[model samples]
Each structure stands twice: as structure tokens, then as C-alpha cells.
Target: MTDPLSALEAAVQALPDDRTLRVRYAELLADAGRHGEAIEQASVVLREAPEDEAAKAVVRRAALAAAEPPGSTPAAAPPDDRHEDIDWSELEASIANPTEPPFVERVVAEHDEELVAEAGETAEDADPVAELRRETVRLADVGGLEVVKRRIDESFLQPMAHPEIAAAFGKKLRGGLLLYGPPGCGKTFLARAIAGELGAHFISVTLSDVLDRFIGESEKNIHRVFRTAREHAPAVLFFDEMDAIGAKRSGNTFSSFRNVVNQILVEMDGVDSQNDGVYVLAATNHPWEVDAALKRPGRFDRMVLVRPPDDDAREAILRVHLRRRPIEGIDLGDLVRRTKGFSGADLEHLVTTAAEKAMTESIRTGSVRPMRMDDMRAALKEVKPSIGPWVQTARNVAEYSNGSGEYDDMVEWLREEKQL
Candidate 1:
């Protein structure tokens, strides 16, 4: 005789993609006065299906219920008029034509979904590590970022490739490289390419793979991750969002995460384990937010700035995305010239939007139509560069807080782009 609520919770955990199961579990949680859990479950549903009115109601009601003290009756709340002026039709259209899928979707497509489970919960018995025994994408596959590739070759790839030469030069295969850039700029892709070059196993980890609600479990998870990497020696362990996992420890709000950072530092330094052949790589949009200790010598000591694609890279990205699609009259040169500040992901969205337009026209005409330059031009109107805010933030850091000159690469990029 299992408890119904417990059984339902287990089922939802097992099949997270089942929207109906999630909604029912949320409802039961709300009924049981577990408002906080209800809100979390409902929010996960909303993230996947934004138009789920039932999940939205559960969130609103559970939130209100949580505000009341135990044994106190909740008073009827006033209506929320915050969005009364919003144009419903326009909003719906925007939702339908999303410039890009959510971050969760992008990461899940490339890595393990279990690695991105909701905060403060562990994906029980789930192996989130995605190990690529032989990576198919090499540095040659990367469209641009020649400067980044050269830096990696000099610092990491060459040494790993010619161990005898490295030994003769007294260069130990140690330390990690941090790739910082605007979101959707192919940092993860670059990391995979590095692994391909090294001809090693690739494992990408995110915050969800390490954090857990139980005390001491996070530290244990960090150890487990390193151990797995060591077992597959000649491996590349990439941490996607380093800032969240290794935030500055000075803040009281992040005191709980301090141990996690300390554990990472210990593991990176190989204090209690043999990290001889394991290569560590990390990427973050906010390098300034990462723990300063993690940037110390022999850790993520070297940082590289991966900027938006240049002309050649843009053309290559466009061709790769459109090669299999039904397209015609696509002037790659013109499209590349027009998309000056677009990141790799922005270009992908541009192509996807163009394809969607062609699909819509086909539906209306009852005949398949090839995606044309006009369709691309129309998509361009809706898809703007998503890297502006990040560039502005980088400019602020390079100008005001760069006493150590750690962000010199970013400063040089800002000047080249006339943003300084």
C-alpha cells in the first residue's frame, strides 16, 4: 500500500516529459498544502508548455497559499492587472514564432537532460555524463574563432599531442582554460572541438549535474565527477556554466555553495586524486562572477574571449544550416554581410525562421515552396542580434574593473568593434 502522493511523485520524476502527470502531481501537492513544491512542479510545466493554463493556475494559487501562515485562512486576493494592457494577439504571435528555444532545450539537445534537472533535486539513478568515445567534430568544423583555436593549440592541444616534446620542454599537461563569451556564441561547440582534437572522451557537466538538496551530497557529486573523469584518463570534462557552479564566495547568499567551490578547487588541483591526463574546460557568459580562487594559477588560469562569428564563419554557419533544407536564391554573401553582430545561435534562428515562413506559405498554397532570399529577409526583421547586452556588460567590466588586465582580450575586441 504505497502512498498515492509518493507514487505520483516517483512517476513524475521517472517521466518528466509527461505534461499530464506533472500537472496532476502539482495539483496533488497544492491540495496537500505543499505549496512550494507545487509551485516548482508547475513552473517546470510552464517552462516546457507556456500556454498551459492549468499549470499557470496552480502556480498562482500555490504562490498565494504559500504566503499565508500555517492554520491561517487565505483571503481572496485582488485581481492581477499587471498585464492587462498587454496585446494578447501580439504576445501569442511572439510565442509562436520564438526567435530561439529556451536555454534548457538547447542544452538538452546537446547534453543529457538529467544533467539539467530542477534545482535542489537529484536525478536519482540517472547517469547524466555523456561520454563521446570518438568526437566527429574537430577544430576544422568550427566556422571561425581562428584566434581562439591558435591559443588552444599553443596552450593545450600541442602539449597533449606531443607528450615527449612537452616533457623535454618541462611543460606539464595541467591547468584549465576558461572560454568566456556572450550566450549562444558556440562556446560549447568549441569545447567539443577541443576534445576532438585531443582524441579523448568528452563529458559536459552543468549545475544540475552537481547540486543536490541534501547536505554534503554536492561535495560528493563533485568528487564523483572528477573520479569519472580520471577513470577515463585522457578525457575532457567541460563545465558549461562555471559562474553558477563557482560563484564568488564573499557573498552571504552563496555561503552554501562555498563548499562546492572549495571541492572543485581541490579536485582541479588534484589534491586527493591523480588528474594526470584529464583536461578541464569551462565556459561562462559571466567570467567576472566566477570565484577568484578558481582563476588562480594551475586552475582556470587562462581565459579566452570567443566573440560573434566573422564573415567567413557566418557564411559557413549559413551553409551548414541550409544545406539540407529546400532553399533557393539564397545569397550567402549578402546574408553574411547583413548579420554583422549575430552569434552562431542567432544565425541558426534566422535560418529556422525562414524555413517556418516557407512552411506557412506551403500550408496556405497547398504546395511545397522553397525557402527564398525574401523569406530570409522577412525572418531577419524579427531576429535581431542577441549579443548586445552581453557585449555592453563586457565593455563595463573591461573599462572599470580590469585593474589586473585579465579582461584585456575583451578590451581589445571592444576597441576593434568600436564599442570602447
Candidate 2:
């Protein structure tokens, strides 16, 4: 006689709408220790007929079984059969009202009352610098971009490391450093590495961390960020997307935005030039969009261009992304050669696409398979280099707006790459 579970699986495959068959199959899968498959089967039933008690019970039991640690006997289902793995409350609420939005689309709640550090303190009043952390990544962790690294070392790291030598030579370990490059080129990562090299705490601030809906709140947030860094002396306060926060005052329509920019200018200089130990680092994809005042002397005067990863960096990125996934016969050197001009993010997407293709094949064949070279080749065809438009824009800027020799380095790079 044909095995009952196998027959049911085949039957369900043929008639997928058979709710009764799927529930029974799910139960059998749970009994056989295939809890993941069992939960999937039961979830399908719940989606269609959410009030189905039997399907709900199966899901609860299977989810609980799946959460159990290996080598431990499965515990009996409790009266409520609630499992922490799945949000049962949210699932039931969604089932009750199908019009409700999914969890991903739901808005996160505002900062809670407990986030108030003191009585009568509002959300905006809270210290926005709570995310300060010690960075372990150094320049060595960064694979390529030798030119960018060298610029950082000579300009920032070396001076801080040998302060005595720098003072002797009349070099000040002050002034903001602005890193301009295409997006996902590891500017933020490099900033963190610089902080680590200095053995300082890293505090990264983005647009959301500074911008507020209320008037005067945005400027307050900016002050808070600098104040936090000052309190934690020898800290690196990194602004991830400086263009958004320090947009050109002339271009901004809102007075509030101009005020925010003015506040940033004031804070960067610090009160009585007390910003000795607080290192300010900012990154922007569009340096041309940043306010000219912010880039003036005594501000973000020093600038570095972080271009896309080279061959070695691309290979390192691919290896990192694919380390956990099962892969076969992948030529790292060939991949690196082919992925020229690809950013770190683009390489990660390529790996993800290849893994997804392998997974789809595995699902269709009912057997797990490793990502192969063919999968990677197919993925490469689909995922083109995303840095083309950025490069073109940079080239145009280098050509037209580089009268002051500001973007001379970019001009040199464009000519070197024959993109000019």
C-alpha cells in the first residue's frame, strides 16, 4: 500500500485547495519532526479559512515544536499553545480583519514615555546620541580603495596617532573631513573604521536622527549630537548623508532647513573652539549639493572621494555575502574581473539573486541544491552595474564645475578610467 503521508502530499500537490487534506498532511509532517513544512502547510489553511480551529491548532503545535531546541524532547502543547516564534496575537488580528495592513507596512510607535530620561522631558528632548558604540573595524578590514585609505591616513589617522609629530610640524588635528562618493561605496564603513583606528567611540547620525516635524527641533537634535560627542571626548561623530541635512541654503525653500544648516555651521565650530576631542566626519553622494559654507575652511574643508570597489574589494564582498550559502565551483577571480564597476551593494545583490535562483530550483525538484557557476552567470545577466548614472553625473561635474580645482581628483580618476 502507498504510504498515507506520501499519498496525501501528492494529493495536495494535485488539488492544492483541499483544506482537509492539507491539515492532515501538516499534522503528519509535525509528527515526523518536519515542523517547518508542517507550519507552512497549516499557514496556507489559516490564510483561507482563519476560523478553522483544527488548522490553528496544527500551526500552534508545529510552531512550538519548531522552536524547541535540538536534543531536547518536545514539550506537550499548553492549554493556549502560544509560541514566541510567531506573533499569534497579530496573526489572529490580521485574520479577523483582512483589511488591516501587514506588519511591515505598519508605522513604528513614537518614542515611548520610558525613553524620557527625566520627568517632563519630551521625545525631542531625549538624547539623540544613545547609539554611540566602539567600532572594531579598521582600515585593514576594508579590502581595496588603497587611494582613499592613504588619503585618510595622511589627513586624519596619522595626525591623530602621532599628535606630537603633527604639533611639531604645525598640523592641527581639527577641521571636518567630508567623504564624497557614489552610494554604497563603503563611506560609512570607512568612517567607522577611522573611529576604530582612533580608539574613539563612533556615533553615526543620519537625516532621520536630526530632522524633526516641529519647529526648532531639528536644530536641537543637531546640537544634541555634537554635545553627546563632546561629552564622550575622543569620539567620532559621523553624519551618514550630509547632503540631506546640510543642503544648500539658497536652494532650500523652507526657512527651517536653512536654520538647520546654520545651526550645523555654528555647532561644527563649537563654542569657544571646544571641539578639540570631537572629530566630525560626513559623507555625501552629491558633494555639489552640499552648502558651500559647510565646505569652507574650519568646517568640512578636507574632502576625499570614495569610488566603487576595485577587483579585490568586489571579490571580498562576494565572498562575505556567499560565505554561509552553499556554492559550487565559483571562480572568485573571474567574478572579480567581470564585476568591475560594481559597488559593494551590487555585488551583494548578485549573490542574493544567485542564491534565490538556486533555492527556486531546489523547491521545484524537492531537493536542496548548491548555487553553481551557471546560477551566478544567469544572475550577472540580470543584475547590471548600478553605478553608471552616478559616474556620468560625477564626470559632468568634474568637467563643468571644477573651475576651482575642487574636483581635480575626480577629474584625474575619470580620465584614468577613460570615462572622461
Candidate 3:
């Protein structure tokens, strides 16, 4: 058709109540410079489905485009949405611009409006674990970390997945384990993997997901989170960025903060409360900041240190990012060798930066060109591993906090890696 937008507009007129088709129509309208109409169409969906984060994104972009100069380019939409790929930008970056405000957050959409009408699962809610979308993230999906996977299988995953064996072996089926590592080292990703491994619903709570201002609200949130998991037996409730909520209370004297940590302890105690099938998973970039009480037994007792990915894992990560994009036969081995210290997140950015350069070339020549090795080589120069400072901070913690041997795993790792 000569005018796809016009044809789509007519189709929308025919099926005005078709929200799905309207969504498609709105995308075309935004592309056709009709931001106002696009905004209206997207708002209709939002009113009907408030939890649709992508619909919210469409509205935000339409509003931004309407306010900007005519013919100005809109920010790039997040990549790899059609598949089960990671868009750190959408999960953590903004669509209006990667650097801009109101970042697109990942909210697991509800399949049936009346069946379970809630934003996300909480520790308090009866079915809190049922709220988050459950994906099949196998351990194989994790690029590297054979050792970490084995450790988790023994200490965390196998126990939860096989309760009969756990009970027979005098092991506790329901308990918490902590995943501590540098940022973007795939703690959240591993949590999802555990959920997939167990074939259970997953509820992941971040600092942004749970903190409250008024007195007792945060504690209430914590109880609700655990209760939700308990209600949905065989569920995984992951607390991300745990340091923010469970920071050490010794040097710092914030009564409210201490209360939150105490509440976590109470909820994790399966003796008073029957927590048979619920699995508690938590992750932190700054383990030292986490309250020592949280590290005790029956709580987040077992700690798995998620170090930087090995060469194979890094190569696997690079392949996933490059899979959907237009690219020539780039050398994955050479890329892996050269980018020795690159984290998964860094590799994602490296591929994105490379793709952006190829896109710029396409725009310049009016013809699409596949990404080349040179584009990647240039991007490699721009992106560096962002893990040095985090590891250094962890080293300091190991140095000062070894009296209790709580950080012995970290100390041993630093020693082996010669990072001490």
C-alpha cells in the first residue's frame, strides 16, 4: 500500500474497540508525525490496562515528540522486545533517551484481568509469588559460571526443587540464599534461572519495588512479600539491591532501617511460620552494606559470589546480543579474548554501540549495511569493565570484616584471583 498509516487508520476505524490493533495503529501514527492522535490511542489502552509498561512508554514518547520541534527525531525504542532477550536499557534505561528520565521498567503483564488483578506480588500477599511472570531461564542460559551453578545446585536450587530429598537428608527445603557480586554480573538473571529450574512462579522485589516512607509501611511490605510466596507454594521471591533495605545497623543508627531488617528475619523463620515450598533469593552489589543479621543462618545464610564471566560465558553473551541484529561474521573468539574483563552488561552495550554505528551508516547512505568487525573494534575501545571499583570496595570489606569470617569466601576469591 502507498499509505500504510492511512490504511491502518481505516482498519482502526472499523475495529475501534480492538485494543491490540489500536496499539499497532498508534505506533504508525507516532511514526507519521501524528503524536497527538498516537497519545490518545495509547492512553485508551493505559486506562483499560494501567500495568502495560510498553503502552506507558508509547504515551511518554508521543508526549515528548509533541513538545519537541517538528521533524525532530524521537528517541530509539528498546531493542529485542519480540524475543526473550535482555534489554538492560528497557529494564534500566529510558526509551525517550537512554540518559533521560522515566526509564521503562519491566512489569510482568497480567494474562487475565479478573483472575489476578495486581501490579506485582508482595511477601504479604497470599499469592505474591504468582504475580511476577515466570520465564524458563535455564542454567545453560547463564553464559558462564559452571562453579557458581554447581554451588547453587547443591546449596539452593536442588534443595528447593526436590523437597523429598531435602527432608530425607536433614536439609531445610525453605530458606534464603544471597547472591553477592558486582553490578550487571547477572544476579537478577540467575534468580530467574532458579525460578525456571524449579518450574515455579517468580516474584522479584527491588529497592524501588518495596521501600516506603511512612512508619511501619516498609515492614508491612516485607511481610507481604514473604506471605505472597508462602501462599503460592513452590515460588521464588527475589530481593534485588538488598543493601539498600538491609544495610548494617551497627555504625549507622536508623531505627526505621533496623526495623525493616528485623522484619525480614521474622518472615524468613519457617519454625514460627510454615514455609515449606517457598524459596527466598536475594542479591546485592554491596554485601558489606547488608546487615550482618541478614547473613545469619535460616536467613540469607548461604552466599554465592558471582564474579565476572569467563571467556566462554562472555562469548555466549556476545552471541545472544548479536543474534537479532544485522551483522557479518564477526570473530567471537577474538572479541572474547580482547574484552577480558567485560561484564555481561558491558558486552550488551558494546554490541549496541556497534549497531548504532552501523545504523548511522545506513542512514547516511540510504541503504542498510551489516555491522562489521571494525564497528565492534571501535566500540570495544569506548566501553570498559565497570567492575573494578565494586571489586575494590569488596576487597576493603574483606580486609576490615574478616574478624567474624563472614567474608571469608570473598577473601579466598580475592586471594586466588590476586585481586587482594
Query: What TM-score against the true fold does each predicted structure earn?
Result: 0.71, 0.71, 0.68
Q: Which residue segments of model 2 deviate by more than 4 Å?
A: 1-126, 169-172, 270-273
By summed lDDT, the worst window of 10 consecutive residues in model 2 runs over 97-106
What tens-digit string does per-residue lDDT give for candidate 2 at 1-420?
999889999999999999999999988988888776776687667545645778777755665566567798998666564555766645442332122212112222355456674446655456754579999999999998899999999987877888789789986666589999888889999999999999999999988787753335567778888888887878999998899889898875344467778888989875655787788999999999999999998899889999899877887899999999999999998899989889899999999999999999999999999999999999999999898999999989997998988888888888988999
Clashes of 1: 0
RMSD of each: 12.3, 18.0, 16.2
TM-score quality measure for candidate 3: 0.68
Q: Note the clash tally of each candidate.
A: 0, 0, 11
Residue 256 error for model 1, in Å? Answer: 3.1
How much lDDT does candidate 3 score? 0.75
* Best candidate (score: lDDT): 2
Off by over 4 Å in 1: 1-132, 252-254
**What TM-score would candidate 2 get against the native?**
0.71
Model 2 error, position 339 (Å): 0.8
